[model samples]
Target: MYLGSQEMRTVLERDNGTIQKNLKKLTFYYGASDLWCPVQYYEDIKKDFPSGDIRLCKKGIQHAFVTSLTSSREMAAMIRDWLKDDLAEM
Candidate 1:
């Protein structure tokens, strides 16, 4: 399965609530650089998801930085690298 990137239709419909709940049991490594999800959502999700490992990337830029190139590619890459590192620990 893909590490990230959910189906747009399901995401727009908020069908991911159940999946989000399920993911509560799994580790989470959020991009501190995220604009779309943001740190607020990450904090909220972490609150409900205490069972899993929680972390954030202390990098620069917005959420789209990962998928976008504009100056923040390195920051996004750092976030992705952090995710990989954390996942390996899991």
Candidate 2:
């Protein structure tokens, strides 16, 4: 995840337009109590990318949700369901 995230960040940093273009169609899910990410970052992202679908986790899952199979499954299912409409159109 770290390597992929860094690579993607590098690509996006090369062009602000690229970030904006892709971000416009993104749905970001941030943990409500994420220790790695402060709440202010989430607030700022919402303001910065108003067109993006940003949401806070309401299921009480910690930032390290991948550590638990149940949390991972739940998040995967939710994301798949969320993208179903756009995926179908594609």
Best by lDDT: 2
What's the lDDT for all of these models?
0.63, 0.79
What is candidate 2's local distance difference test score? 0.79
lDDT of 2 by residue, 1-90 (tens): 898698867855224476588985777788888886777767878887777788888898888788999998998899888889788978
The TM-score measured for candidate 1 stands at 0.45
Model 1 scores a C-alpha lDDT of 0.63
Sliding window of 10 residues with minimal summed lDDT for model 2: 10-19
Inter-residue clash pairs, candidate 1: 35-63
Model 1: residue 88 alpha-carbon error in angstroms? 9.0
TM-score of every model? 0.45, 0.72
The C-alpha RMSD of each candidate to the native structure, in angstroms, is: 6.5, 4.2
Clashes of each: 1, 0
Pick by TM-score: which candidate is best?
2
Model 2 segments more than 4 A misplaced: 1-17, 88-90
TM match of model 2 to true structure: 0.72
